[model samples]
Target: MKMDYVSSGIGKTDFLQLRKLYPLFVFSRVSWENRLDHLYIEYEFWTGKNSRNALFFRPSLKVYGRPIEKGSAEWLDPFLFQLGLIELISYWKATCSPEILIQAGSLAASQIKWWQKLYLKGLGEFFFRNGIERDYPGILHIECDSAKQFRPVEIFSLQGNLIPVGGGKDSFLTLEWMKEEKENNLCFLLNPIKAQWDTLRYFSYPLDQVIVVERQIDSLLLGLNKKGFLNGHTPFSALLAFLGTMLMALYKIKNYVASQESSANHPTVPSESINHQYSKSYEFERDFQKFLADSLCPSFSYFSLLRPLSEIQIARLISEIPGALSVFQSCNKNRHCGGWCGHCAKCLFSFLIFRPFVEAQKISGIFGSDLLEKQSLFSLFLSLCGKAEQRPFECLGTEEESLAAASLLWHKAKATGKKPPVLIEKLFSQYPHLLMTRNAIQATYDLVNTEHSLPKKFLSLLQKNVIKKALFDD
Candidate 1:
């Protein structure tokens, strides 16, 4: 089943008692899958010694019918332990349980501070959304008992990259840029969807190159959520980062490349730090890299390939790629429909961001309608353009980026002596100064803030392989 399946559950008061009674959350054992073609993982979480919750997370990889390598038990143990920690972190978000107890797994003293920062800062938006005040002391605490000392694992040196596809344009751009290395590259997804499959098919790789992992959240958490537990957003990108670390130890893959763009660095709110994409931000990425090097295996590298590119640039680059126009779907609400719902912030933002690059008809074709033409969506357009006070809590570019795209398109239409699109015309009328006047749009497009942890070795290769050479024009 798809991960986004929503079920109707009894809504009750926020279960404040559960948090008060069970102040500690524990990371327990991992049930490793030794099956022929499955990479199954089951993790256990505990509120106390007796109260427990367990969930199954599996990403099935066929490995092209190859036999399992021998003598992996020793090195794989620590990786599995860390994977269990990552899984436990997400489950802990359900209740915001103050103390995280790792009875067996160990982290360095400094590493503990790093994990604490991730949990608190990453959950800032969650706290804000649930109206849960975080002004109390001892709210985010972690206890780690060293089970084993850290030891360096031998690098896999497989001459391959492991790319996690998220069924979005950003990942598609990353996949396209890395196409030359496709012979040595592998793709994986947690809970494979049609858009992901369509992207994989577009690349025409051997079926064995793709790995699918099904991540199942425990029903107990959902039941508790239904019972009105403190339910809100968790930093899923951080969870993905941990999963990548686990896969590196298991498969010995050299690089874990994700597709988080630089735009994610912007907060969901203008002046505050509450961001829905906190895990995808450069701060979290840098911190994760440091923790990985100091605590986990240094032989493996994790980084985002699209770190330097803005959302506008990414949208433009994706437009140049073939086949993704119809296959790609980033709308979280319209997943069952297999494309844009035309009603949510994601759909509106994506439609607006791509207008300057992709043809109007083709963009409309992808979404089944011209989103700019929808008058009912004017309020959402206002919010996306920063005219409204509340920014939509979704993975969108900054207000300036959206406004710049709208302005650039308006000028482009005027240059051709054609009337602007409905949304563009409306936005131009209200915020005329927001439009890019006298090459200002070019400046924003060229402003690639250098706040990323991309390795120096891959920089030149990324510049050369990107769909648009202008990606490096800055």
Candidate 2:
């Protein structure tokens, strides 16, 4: 018999928890943003009235059949050294759609199904919405089935530990928390970096010894171009699973710790995405946790360390902790010449969130630029302060933050020449017109003068917390 079909487009997601949405179609005019060529994606899944052994998959996506230079962003001369966004795009297309355009086996897109969605919605609202700074709306149209199609994933306990790392907030907080709990004897994964470990140095993590996984997907990527195999999102979970398997095969430590922030629970909005943010949702976390358990040999565990903190809270923690803000760079697309390259949305949000703790001058210095020249940045940021047509999981702060940053910008504009930063001058031109910006400044100042609510969240997850005791009991 043919498989029963269930699918949908994800609309304004309930931040943190994974709720179900059917018939979801995420459409975006990305070319307007000058980011890429215009394209769209559609995702579908199936779960029948009966079938315990249901298959998890993504329908194939056939995008960019030609060169990106020919209006296919796929071929736009790659980032200075980075690899491919198409790898992610193609992965999403094939795994959810019925088509089989790409041959990159199961990545994280498997969670774009029904079982995962319901599971997360069942959990209390302990999730983060989309945190990327994209101006796209998620329109997931859900199609439900009454019969059972839940393919339970087996959890494998392992004898090995996986330490996920990058040069950013999640890994830094995770490593610190783990070490404080005396779980220093875990494994570490580094994706063939050109520099020394980024987050590890932040907390002065003791390094008597540890397990490490270094991937070499670069040449494999270029070589696989003729057919142009698109790799879905990093099987970050799978990578950890393989680490657990390696531990079983080698050292035998199954405690793999994923440093993904709780904020990652906020899904990403894809331009032309028919469905959005499937991999990072809470449902994915829970189901994949089980999938790893079921598929692995035995004794493996993967869990996010920052499940309790918001992005702002996470940023607050990073600031209080030394060395984190000083050396991390999180942008993927940029024309920057120095540090943090404050052009990408990541850098902009990081600076905005840090407004309370660090002065603007210090932040610009850290990112290796002065605010005097970032006219377009202030424009994009000011836009967020106003009401959004679709309130997404924006990385931008509230009215308080926008005003605080704007106050600083206004002061700087007083000294700036009458050029394109006219918006800067406009801030003070009519106070009532920029009500949101004004309110944001007042809120920011009030909060700052008050007890400061940012770092409190991290303090709960610190060394003294009772749950933390079990996390580091190595």
Clash statistics: count for each candidate: 3, 64
| Deviation in Å, model 1, residue 333 alpha carbon | 1.1
Model 2 residue runs over 4 Å out of place are: 1-161, 194-196, 202-208, 218-250, 267-277, 297-299, 334-338, 371-373, 382-474
> Candidate 1: how large is its RMSD?
4.7
Supply candidate 2's per-residue lDDT for 461. 52
**Per-candidate local distance difference test:** 0.73, 0.39
Candidate 2, residue 441: CA error in Å? 10
Query: Per-residue lDDT of 116-219 in model 1, one digit per residue for the tens?
Result: 78777787887777666555467778887557655556655545788988788888888888888898787877777888888888888666777666677777
TM-score of 1: 0.90
Q: Give per-model TM-scores.
A: 0.90, 0.51
Best by TM-score: 1
